[model samples]
Target: MDPSRVVLFKSLSKTLSPALGIGWIVAPPRWTQQLHRADQVDAQPSALDQLAFAELLESGAYDRHLRSCRQRYRLRRDTLVQALAKQLPDAPVSGVAAGLHLILRLPTAVDTRAVVTAAAARSLRVADLATYHATDDHADHGLVLGYGNLADSAVIEAVRHLRDAVEECG
Candidate 1:
């Protein structure tokens, strides 16, 4: 490896480690042999085989993959937020950051179970936030809508149905 390239790579790795909360740096494999050695594989795994993928995760290969996946998810999350704000501005949505899910705080009268039931009746599935969080007095009831699997049209329709469910409950 060129000394200049190594220095540059180390500098960038140092910068990203703090941002990512990673304390250690691992060098990228330049050869298939190096990758196999890093993963501690004595033999190659076939395409149809499920090998020690978890062991290779310690090599930071999984984290590298996750970083790319996270970038895509962030874009989707932004689009979802934009759609929700345009469609249901009155609804309380939270956690518009990098994550697989976000919370929508529905009106107090909006029974989350009823909303889920209504959504299911319409051939949709959603989760209630209250079920996961501990709330004795049943504070703002809502659903924890995840955009990981939801298409843009489905999210829009689900939000619309959610608004209707709240209105119907009231």
Candidate 2:
């Protein structure tokens, strides 16, 4: 990858709280200029929010919070994986190990939408993997399960609900 052509953007919304509405970007000089022009037409984050973020970073609080988040997510991810294995062995779960969410691939004959709907009825929110695709033709049958904000017991319980939903819908 050419660094000159690359732009990296990150937001505190994911790692920190969404309420912060803070983020940063690194881009080529030309891209930066264009982005600055665009920013003039768009609303920017509040000055207070930016100052709070700066203080958090300067005080080393951000790093400490990130370490805690990573540890929590790791435990949640492992718990979700184990629960899925025990509760829904037939469905294969796959994704990068470090993320807040994972994808559970259903059998080809299964209707992912129906499963999602059923899961919702049971108060367990799940996303159809196909919805993330740009086109229906490229979509696959699966569920996107996020465990980042859930407790260990909640993750297991969610997976159990998912298993029941699959059984009812599959």
lDDT of 1 by residue, 1-170 (tens): 75423422222223232333222223444544664466644453343322334444668876786687677677778777777777667676887763678887776666778888887777767788878867656665777888877774566676677666656665
| CA RMSD of all predictions | 10.9, 2.3
Output the lDDT of residue 23, model 2.
Answer: 82
| Residue 49 lDDT, candidate 1, scale 0-100 | 25
Instruction: Kindly list the per-residue Cα lDDT of model 2 for residues 57-147, writing each as its tens digit.
Output: 9999999999998887887888888889999888889994747889999987888999999999999989999999988797468999887
* Clashing residue pairs in candidate 2 (N, C-alpha, C atoms within 3 angstroms): none
Clashing pairs in 1: none
RMSD of 2: 2.3
Q: Whose lDDT is greatest here?
A: 2
Error of 2 at 75 (Å): 0.9
Our tally of clashes for model 1 stands at 0
After superposition, the stretches of candidate 2 with alpha carbons farther than 4 Å from their true spots are 29-34
